[model samples]
Target: MTMTIAFAGTPTIDDAPGIDWREQAACRNHPEPNLWFPVGINDPCDDAKDICVNHCPVRETCGLVANRTRERHAVMAGFRCSDPDEFIDLRIWLGVENPARRTRTCRHCGVKFSTRHPRRRACPECRDLVPLEPVHRHIQHLRNVGKYTLRGIAAASGVSVGTVSLLAKGQSPYEGPYVSRAIAARLFAVTTEQEAKTA
Candidate 1:
């Protein structure tokens, strides 16, 4: 029998201070234990946003927090989920206010990412994740090349400070399988050995 493995990707946890699952359950008249669990792509009905809209005294603040964090990934109140496609939709509808596009791809998985900062190596989801050896090699390249400063690398790569920081620090860059392979190859090809031998 060919068994398929499924892993949860999205961050649906409500870790905001002064807000708990119990409060959400009470607000929505749902069971406490059930609401506490993280919602996946399958559980579409878990309208946590509606709970925020109705129960949260700081409704606007809550929405702002959710929006700012880019955490709301599905029917958040009346607002659609904050998926990558949704962001694209929002950008099309409301206009991408931020000049920077903080999206990235993962070397391990083909999934895409939408972060506050651009990624240099791997996506946030892939950071520290035990996967392939090439990913490690890629991160090491960033460090050896004095790409430690996130903001500096971001400016240079046109990626993002967050991404550069993650890559330099040995963390995953983003989600989609879109590593800057061309750049990495070029950088790696010009090894220190060649430079020293030339001198």
Candidate 2:
């Protein structure tokens, strides 16, 4: 596997563009720098990958570094020198502190944000101006009416179960107008009636 990887066209430093290999090389050798990899190959969990991909800007470079070092365990850049028996025992491998904390960084705005709520992507500033799809709204209604699951709501609304889950989780941020109206007619009936009363 190592032989195959090494021969796979060193991917000229420039060929694999959009990432800084020189700077990363410097950081790799730097006396004090952040590490990227954190798991041993035989590690018992799968969640660390979330942190690696989330925080990594040049994830490919980090992976290459891990391979070059011939690390038997999954290592983030240099996040783990040796595999610890457990995650809590993990200490600073590179420069990152508290890898357990989930945070989001916008690629477009380069803004850093954190959230305690799940199913959220952009910060409030990015999300507030965006309109909600009607299909999503309908899914919410089914959930409120004791559906309690995406499959149940999808069955009732004739939408895909995956689509319903994405709507409920806020993962499907884009939708067509037809789906939007269907969602509104189903979920906002009570709210619309209340609006008519005030009107």
For each candidate, how many residue pairs have backbone atoms clashing (under 3 Å)? Answer: 14, 15
Candidate 1 on 117-194: residue-level lDDT in tens?
Answer: 332334544342233235446546545664434454455445445654555555544443333443344333433334
How far out, in Å, is residue 46 in model 2?
A: 49
Any idea what lDDT model 2 has?
0.42
If scored against the real structure, what TM-score would every candidate get?
0.24, 0.23
Off by over 4 Å in 2: 1-130, 133-138, 173-199
lDDT, candidate 2, 107-141, per-residue tens: 22235887533334445343322235554565565
lDDT against the true structure, per candidate, is 0.42, 0.42
Give the range where candidate 2 is weakest over 10 consecutive residues by summed lDDT.
Answer: 1-10
**Cα-lDDT of candidate 1:** 0.42
